[model samples]
Structures are given as C-alpha cells and as structure tokens.
Target chain A: MAHILLIDDDAGLVDANKLVLEAKGHEVSVAYTGDDAWKLLEKRRPDLLVMDVMMEEFTSGFELARDVSIKFPDMPVLMLTGVQEHMRSDWKFDEDKDADWLPVRKFLAKPIPPTKLAEEIEAALKAAKEKKGKRPS
Target chain B: MAVSEKLKVIVCDDEPKMCSAIKIILDGFRPEVRTLGVEAELEVSLVSTGEELLTRMETDPADLVLLDYKLPGISGMDILGRFSEEKRETAVIIMTAYANIETAIQATRLGSFDFLAKPCTPEEVRYTVKKAAHHLIVSRHARLLAQEKKRIRFQFISVLAHELKAPINTFDAYLDVMRDMTLGKDMTAYAGIIAKCSERTDGMRKMIADLLDLTRIESGQFRRAPAALEVAGALAAAAEGVAAEAARRGIKLETEGAGLLVEADPSEVGMILNNLFTNAVKYNRDGGLVRASAAADGGKVRITVEDTGIGMEKKDAARLFSEFVRIKNRATIGIPGSGLGLAIARKLALQAGGDIEVESEPGKGSRFTLSLPAPGSIDLKAA
Candidate 1:
C-alpha cells in the first residue's frame, strides 16, 4: 500500500477522498492548501502526491509539484482539478506536452470516479517504482 | 455621467485681446452650460505663448486646447502634430486669421477637433467646445467601460467555475465512498456523509441563487418590494436558520434590541442577515460567542453581528466585501464559502438605501454593522 498525500483547498473533498483511499488499504494524509502540503512534505515525504491545481493561488499545485520533483525525484505526483477546461484553458495538463514543465505523472479531471482516482494513483506509483529500479544505484 | 470632474480648457494665442475674447466667451457660457443641463465644469486657462502652454500642459494637462495656427515659436499646426504624435487626449481647435482650405484640411488630418477663423462668434466657440466636452467624456467612459467589461468577464468565468465545481467535486467523492461501501456494514456509518453531501448541495443552491441575485441587482433588474420590516423578527429568523450549525460548532448566538423598523425588501434583508450570520459562525472559533444586536441610531436602523472569530487585519477587513475575496491563511484554510455572500449582501443593502460597515481587530473579533434607512425615509429608487 502506497502512502499518499492529498492536497486540496476543500475540506469536504479532502475528507471524502482520504476515506476512500484509506478503505483501499493505502495510507493517506490530507492538507487543505498547497503551503500546508509543502510543510507536511518537508516533515515526511509521502510515496505519492495527489494535489488540486487551484488552491491558494492559480498555479500553487504546479509550484508544489515542481518543488517535489526537485526535492524527491522518485516520488510520483498526480494532479487533480475541477472544470480545468472551463477555468484555465491555457494549461491543458496533457502529459505528452506538459510533462516537461508540469512535473506530474498523471492528470485527473474533477468529478472523477473514485475507481479512476485509485487506479491512476496505483499506476503512477508502479511507474515510479519501475523508473527507480532502472536507475543506477 | 453625473461626474463632477473638471474639464480644463487652455487658450494659446500671441494676441492679448484674442486671449481674453476667447476666455470671456467660454467663461460666459458656464451659466448657460448649467442651464443646458450638461453636468460638466469648464476651467479655462489662457497662455499667451506656446512655451508657457507646453510648460503648463506638462504640469497640468488641459482636456482641450485652442491654438493659433500662425503663432510665433510653436505654430498651432506643429503643436497639433506633436500632440497627435504623443497621443495626448487634449482636443485642439486651430484658429487663424489666414484660414484656408489647405490649412484646415491639413489641421483636420493632424487631429484638430475643429478649425475656425481669427474672429470666431461666441456661438461657434460655445458649440465647438460643447461638442469637444461630449467627445472627451463619452470616449473616456467608453474606454473605461470596455476595460471593465473584459476584466469582469475573466473574473466571472473563474469564480463561477470554482464555485460550481467545488461542490460537484465533493459530491462525487461522497457518492464514490457510498457506492463502494468504503465505510462498510452499518448504514448509519454513511449518514454523516449523506448529510454533508446534502449540505454541499444546499451550498451550491445558495451560490446559484446569490449569483442570480447579484447579476439582477447589478443590472438594475432586481424587483425590490420594500415593506416596513421589524429588525428583531428578521434578526431572530436569520439566527434560527444558522442555529443548528452554530450549536454544532458550540458558538453562542444571541441577539438584542427590538422595535427598530426599516423599509426594505424582506428577502433582501433576510439575505443580508443570513450572509453575515453564516460568516460569523463559519469563521468563528469553536465555542466562540456571536452577538447580533439591533438598534435605532440617528434616523437609521443598524444591525450589528459581532463574532469572536479569526478576525482579519485592518487592510483585509477593508476589502472584505469585494467580489470573491476569501482570506487565505492557516486559520481559514478549510472554511467552505462562496466569497460572494458579503458582496451580494452589501449590494442588496445599498440598493435598499442602506450600507454595510465593518470594525475589527485581528484575533480579538469582528463586528459588521448594516445600517438601513428608517421608516418615512426617501424612496430607494433614487440610488
């Protein structure tokens, strides 16, 4: 089971998602803002990060993702946002083009099924593990 | 526009008599300007040379300039060319004894508002100046309106998207937890989630209603049915709506004073009261005290909602009532709010011939005072 850090400004979403992830036997911790998430990450790194794009500021999650990539290169980052196409059309979060700068392994649009969220988190964790294994130690 | 902005007009001519003649004519038109019902004041300044004119323009730019095309130092055509090149908004009127079609056409192309012969009739001066004033005011307003529209549309899209999507995001998660029976076994285990889901749905409904009311009020389309409303009844009613949440949070909710009456729409007052009430509870520390009081102060009925919550800095409180402004800090991180509540509440209050004011100190508490015109006050439509 992966230890996941879920960061979102909405407490309702944070609490509900934490329960779902915990039910699946994964350890989960939640932060209500990007800053709080960053502070928590500094204390103890999670195996994976699931964060919302819009929080304290528009690109706060992306900023946190970049920091994570620089600090904990092996930890996978998953982006979750709501109505992204409508709110921020400029940042599509497609890994093919956005991977270079976004520093995230997966992008899940909002109102996503719980199954899909869990599936993506698992896939991302597995991908990171494989990438780590290939690296010269 | 009902704007009291002064329109500065500068007259530059080498001739002293010509300067006074133009100034006297324009100055005499002031009373007639008021009589014509155009709400603009003209402040005329006369400069005998272009050097002084340029210096004064640098210090205090004139909205309109009357220049002699054949003057010494800086010819009116040369200055006109410079004004257009620099893109100053000053409307130039080129006057000359040697008025010719070629010069007039060239001046017109150089961006002069109008061309006139050396001795212009008062009627000609008045009419041209009047047209220039209209052009200046209307064009400035148009430019500002265009800019404001763009900004509002961008902000409106983002705010609407976030507000609408937040609840849906939460609702989706809650349903997912329910469907998978993540909590499992006991149906009662899901009851809290169900209730929270309902609350999110209710929040969204309130947001939608507030958005509609906000748009209608801003567009002057909101139909307000004003009646004599007793402050105590409305205050109690608003408190009743938040009683459960207040009790759950362990907040002490109380109200004082009675018999204070104001003429306003019931729904409008209810919305204002509920907004202040909800915010007081939502932002308050658990087990905090919230006191709502009403009284007649001067000729207005004032309702004050004081909360022992996480009060903001003086600067934050100043912009607290603006659109979509949520104080983002560790203290307020998990608070669920539309951020449009106080904005709409203040708007409704103002339209009903009232205003919402705030007084607060960080960590101590906050007091939001909403004042409405007492009964027998002037009509609200005047606003």
Candidate 2:
C-alpha cells in the first residue's frame, strides 16, 4: 500500500520487518544505521519511516526522527525501542508528554509479531494521509 | 564490641581531684569498657588544659577524650573544632561547668560525643565514657563496610564485562548471517522469531560493550600499553574516524596543535579523544561547531574539546563521572547514552597519569580538558 523505510542496527529485525511489509504488498527499504538512513533520504523519500530508538548511538533514531520532521515535514515516523526493560524503568510512551521530543506518530516496543507489525504499518500510513489532508493546502 | 581488647581514654580536667575521681570510677568500669574492645587494663592519659591535651594527642591519640570546657589557653570548644577539622576518629566527651542547653547544643554541633556538668558523679563519667567508646566502634565498622561495598561493586562490573559480552556478540553476528540467508517461502513463517532473537542479542551486545569499557578502565588495563605518542596525532586520528558522521549532521569538526607529545599508549589516547569528539558531535546543536586543540605546558599535554552544544547544570556535572548516571531532561531525552563514558574516561585518564576537567553552562556549550603527563616530565622510578 505504501513504501516504508526501516532503520535498525539489527539486520535480522530489519529483514523480518521488510518481509512482513513486503508480504502485505508494500515496498520496503532497509538501513542499518541513522547515517545510512540519512544518506538514503537524500536520494528518495519513503511514505513512512520505521526506526529503532537505539542504533549505532542510543538516541540516533530519535535524532533522525527530529531531523525528518524538520526537513521532511509530511513524512510520518514509527519508533521501535528495546531499552525500557534493560533499563528497568517503567517507561511507556505518553503522547502528550512525549509528542514534542519524540515526534513520532507511533511507538512500539521490540519483538512485535509480523501480523501486528503489518497492522501498525497500515494504521500509520492511514493516519499520515489524514494528517496531510488536515494541513492547509 | 569485643571484651578482650583495651580502650585508651583521655581525660582532660583542670582539677587533679576531679581527674583522679574519674579515673577511679573508670577503673571500676574496666570490665564494662573492655566489652567495647578496650584492653582489660585501661591506658588513661590525664591532661589539665587544652594545650597539654593537644600535645598528648600528637604522641598518642586517645580513643575517647573526657574534655573540660574551661581550659587554660584553648577552650574545649576550640579543641572540638580542631578535632572535627582533622577528622580524628577520637570521640570527645566534654565536661563543662556551663552545661546549659545552649552549651550542649554548641558542643554537640562541634561533634562532641556527650557533655557532663562540673559536678557530675563518678558513675555519670564512667557511663558516658563507655557509651562514647561503643559509638566509636560502631561508626568505625560502618565506615569500613561502606568502603567494602564500593570495592565489591567495582569487582562485579569488571567480572560481568569480562565474562559475558564476547559470546553474545558472536551469537548476534550469527543471527545476522541467518537472516541474510535466502530461504525463500519457508523462512517467512519464522521471520518474527528471528527478528526478536536478533533484537535481544543486540541489546546484550551494547550492554557488554559498555561493561567491557567500564571494566578495562576500572581494572587499570589502560596502562598496559604505555608509550610516547604525539597528542595531536591521536586527536587527528580520532577526528578523522568521526568526520563522516559529523558531516552528515552538518556539524563542523576542527583540530589543531600538531606536535604536542605525551607519555601514553597511542590507542588509549585515541580512545579518550574519540569519546570526547563523539560526545562533542552528538551533544551539539544541529550545525554547531566542535573544536579540539592540544598543547604542552608545565610538563603535561593538555587536549581540549569545545563544542557549541547543550551544556549541563553544575550540580549534574558533579555526579556525571559515576556509573549508571546519565543526565536526564527533555533536551537529553532523545539522546541515548550508557552513562559510563565519563566514568570510564576518567579512570583511563588516571591510569595514564592524566585527568579530565569539564566546564559548561546550561545553554552556551561545554568544554572538556584532558591532560596527560608529557614524556620525560614525570619520574618513572618514583611512580
């Protein structure tokens, strides 16, 4: 339905997500780091961005998302994080509190099932289109 | 409290009769005092004024001081201040004629163990001295236990890094290879499972790297390969490595001071500079600047990293070098960090006969200065 760009340091996770998105009949591009994702953004823009919070640097994905929001305003971002459990902090994404800093349309913890991941992709894409329509044209 | 040892109790009373009376009462309380780890025979030192007490303390510091407030030259209040400043573990029991609530509060604030009125009975003196001795033993044990806990924690982190990170890294790499395999339709069903495994392994990998970094610095491994190297060369090498990333962010990276030399392992020097540059780039505002400069002065090579980035609060800076502590706030929320970088860097600097200093303002910028002993400047034989 849409072209999705996935940025993650974990090659296997990127592959798995790519497979699920492709099976759902969407084109997917994978980037192994924030730097790679930025370089790719130079040549082409995807319908949506899916990224892990920690990559080559722990906050790389978050910074990349902020950059995207500034440069590619209409592009939606979905964040995947794997640090909460390891940090032993009871952290959850609160839209109102985190919206300004996180700037992501959707946040997902790691290990999402393929079916659920596809659903999230579809939901994110639909929301992005709605947001774009609401913007003064 | 151990019953077999002896306690050295110093009694400072201007009156000889008063001292003799307290000594007689202490002799009777010997069995009770010995229970607080004092020897069966009490080693008692009797002094008449603060001057005599100070001289006696120099020769043989007592476990407990039974002090008189009205001394000839230095008042007991002054001696208390001196003892607190010296951080002497010796407990002081002030015997005062002005044993009002105010004097007691003043004495206690000066760290007196207890206060006794001038006409206090032999029994009162004996009981107060015994309690002071016991308090000393308990606090001494607590101080030792606190030190022991710190040592154990350092050992635990070192062991975890050394034992756990390698295998996890190997397993993570293998998982990546598996994901790369073109197994077509059959592998689709297991894609989610493979991805989950990969993410878990990757988390372990990051943790292990941080752990190893912490252990290497804590265990004095940085000093393992010491050699004379150019400080500016190490800075250039580190800057070159991160140049691409800095450019991608539209940040400027500049380095100067070409020939300053220091006695340190090149790799360790590289690591210290790399960490500083990475932080300067990572923490800076978009399109901000990072400048690194090195110089030799007073037999030390000083390298400074200055950045136009989000600076930190002075209070936060105090705890920055402690493990597992990261600066937490909105500006830092999106920035990921292990919180061990500065701590490890400081340890490495120490091992390399150097140190790191930081200067920052909330929004202006930050400057980190690392200094290492210049080659031939420090006496190797003495070290």
Candidate 3:
C-alpha cells in the first residue's frame, strides 16, 4: 500500500478522501492549500499524491502538479477536478496535447463516492508500480 | 422596430402648396433613406405657420425640422435663434429662395443644421434628409449601446458571484458527509484542521453573500422584511455572533440599550451590526475594548458601536462605506474582508429611512453610529 498525500483547499473533501484512503490500508496525509502542500513536499514527499485541480487559486492545482513532476519525477499524482463541467471546450485538458504540461497518472471529476475514490487510487498505484518495475533500474 | 427608432420630423412653411411639395419629396425619399441602412423611420408632421410649429414643438417636439426662412409671424432666423437659445435638439434645415453664401453663413451661425434652397431638386433633398436621418439614428444607437453596456456589466458581476459560490457548496457538502462519519468513530486527528477549514469556508461564504446582497440591492431586486425590532435584541444577537473572536483576542465586547425600537428589516440590521462589530474586533489591539449601545435621538434611534483599536486617518474614514474600498495601511494589512459590509449596511439603512455616520481619530479609536426611523416616528409607508 502507498502513503498518499491528499491536498485540497476544501477541508471536508480532504478529510473524506483521507479517511477513504486510510480505510483501504494506505497511510494518508493532508494539506488544505497549495502553499501548504508545496512546503510539505519540500520537507518530505509522500509515496503518492491525491490532489484537487482547484485550490487557493484556480490554476494552483495544475501549477503544483507541474512543480511536483519537476522536483520528484517518480511520485504519482491522481488529480481531483470540480471544474470539468464548466471549462471551455477549447481550454479543456487534452491528454495527448497537454501531456507535456499536465502530468498526472489519472484525473477524476469531483463528488465521486468514497469507495470509487479508493478504487481509483489503488488502480493508479498499481499502474505506477508496474511502469516503474519495467524501467531499467 | 421600437418607437424610439423613429425620427420625428416636422415641415413648417406658410405656403401650403410649397409645404405639400416638400412633404411629397420627403415621403418619396423614405425608402431611399431606408436603403441607406438607417433604422430610424421618418415620422412626418406638417405645420403651416411659425406659431403652429412653436405650439407643436411645445407639446411634442420633433427630432428634425424643415423651416422656410420667409415665414409669416416669425422669421426663419428668429426660429433658429430660439432653438439655439433653448438648446433644443431639433436638427433644423433652413429652406429659403435667397440661399446665397451670406444666408448660409447666417443660418449656420444661428445653429441651422443645413441649408436647402427653394426650387430645390428632389435629388438634393434626398441626400440632405438622408444625412440628417443617419445622424439621428447613429446617435440614438450610441445612447442605447451605452445603456446596454452598463446592464451587461452588472449581469457579469452577478454571474461571477455565482461562479465563486459553486465550489463552496461542494465543499460544504463534503463537510456534511465527514461530520456524519466523525460521529461513528474517532476523527479527532483531523479536528483542528477541520475547525480551521470550517471557519475559512464560513468567512468566504459570508463574503459571497455580501457580494450578492450588494448587487441585488443596486439592481433594485432585493426583497426586504421590515418590522419593529428592539435595538437591544438585534445588538445582542450581532454581538453574540462575534463573541468567540473577541474572546480569543482578549477584546472586551459590551452592549447596553433600553427598549428603543427601530423599524427595519431584521436581516438588514444583522448585516449592518455584524459588519461594524467584526471590524471592531478585527481592527482592535489585543485585549482592547468594544462597546455597543443605543440612545434616543429626536424621532430616531442612535445605535453606536465604539472600539478601542487601531483607528484610521480622517481621509480613510471618509470613504469607509464605499463598496470594495478596503483601507490599506500598515496596521490593517492582512485584515480579511469583502469591503462591501459597510457599504451594504449604509445602503440598507438609507432604504429604511435612516443613515449611518462615523467618527474616528487616528491611534485613538473609531465609532460608527447607525440611525434609523424610530417606531411610528415617521410615516412608514414601505421599507
């Protein structure tokens, strides 16, 4: 199991996701803002990152995700987004087009059931592990 | 097309036969002007004398007028001078048999819109009327566009407020689910973070609500519930809402008032007092004192909230009630607020037949006095 870091400005969502991941036998830590998550990462990086796309600023989540990939390339990030419905069609995240900028193992729309969130986390962790295992170490 | 898109036109000439000719020519050019893409249609009215034209103008003025320079009773130059003197917006085109450079200069000096010679060709009349009609239409469109711009700006603000609120609602729902789960097991590990998040969300929610109220009130759509409210009760309730913050800062909060009654919406008064009290606590030095009380003014009740805190400059207090005007200074840095609280409070007070006034000295303290119509003191038609 992975030690997941849950990051969001919304305290309730952070706590709910923390509980869900903990119940699935994964250790979880939480940060309520981008600044908090940034400091936490610099101090000690978690094994896996579960975060929201909207935080203190509207683009904070994407910016932090990019920063994480630059500093800790191997840490897998699973993003939770609440703005998928409202984003303009042209401004939407295209997996192939935005891969260089948006590097996340998975992206999930918000308000998902707790069990669904836990399931996604497990799947993401397994994929990252398999990808790393095949790499020439 | 709307009625406002019609260009009212009056043709004035003493010779009925000549007036008929110009009227016929103008009527024939209506389609020609329409082809020029002028949305304003010609609304024609005929007046045979200067007196008739003057009387008709007094009742309902036309936007453009065709006046013969040689009219009985009042000369064309006299009519042009009168229009210029009164600053009427009628575009007058002078028609004279003596249409030389001197007359044209005189008419132009007297504020005539254009010159039309008698025995004028239909083609010349067509082009002249076309130009005048286009000017009227373009000016009308400009005015309407300016008004629409204002309306769109207000609508944009309202939409932005709703956009900001959606995420908060989702956050609130998540809190509800977690609270339910907390009761079932040990959730104390996240208790401190949860409390901080709860406080932050509540503050942001209040800011959003304040933003909505200001916009609705400005757009004349806010529904208010007015009643006879006891001053002590409203003051106490508002004070209680900020009591915890005051205690945490070691700031003394006090309220005292007799059975003074003010007729206003309860929620409005709550917003006003909450703004004042919150500012009192947030700006106060640690362990400072905040006092709220009311007194009887002539035909009105004076409710005052005084604070012993870092007061502001006179210039700062002058614009304190303006919407979105947060006073920025060294002492007030990082003070979280929407800056609409005082502005909304003042707006609500004025609507309820009352007003808010403030007095303060830098480094000494500040006091805000809210005066409202005392119960039955004034004719309370509506609030």
Query: Quick one: best lDDT, which candidate?
Result: 1
Give me the candidate number with maximum DockQ.
1
Once fitted onto the true fold, the runs of candidate 3 whose alpha carbons sit more than 4 angstroms away are: A88-94, B1-216, B219-251, B254-270, B278-343, B346-383
lDDT of 1: 0.84
Better of 1 and 3 by lDDT: 1
Q: What is the TM-score of each predicted model, taking all chains together?
A: 0.68, 0.44, 0.49
Judge candidate 2 at residue B315 and give its lDDT.
87
lDDT of each prediction vs. the true structure?
0.84, 0.77, 0.80
- What DockQ would candidate 1 receive versus the native complex? 0.45
Model 3 per-residue lDDT tens digits across residues B1-383: 33325779999998888788877877734532343355556788899889889999999999999999999899889999999999997899999998799999999999988999988888887778877877767676688899999998886565455345544654554565465463346777557546656665676777788888888988879777778899999999989999999999999999988688988889889988988999899989899999999998898999999999889888889999976566654466435566678989999889888999999988878999999988888776654
Please, what are the lDDT tens digits per residue for candidate 3 over residues A1-137? 77888886554456566665665688887787777788888888788998888765679889999999999888888888867554533355565777688988777776665567777888878888899999999
2 or 3, which is superior by TM-score?
3
Give Cα distance to truth, residue A86, candidate 3, Å: 1.3
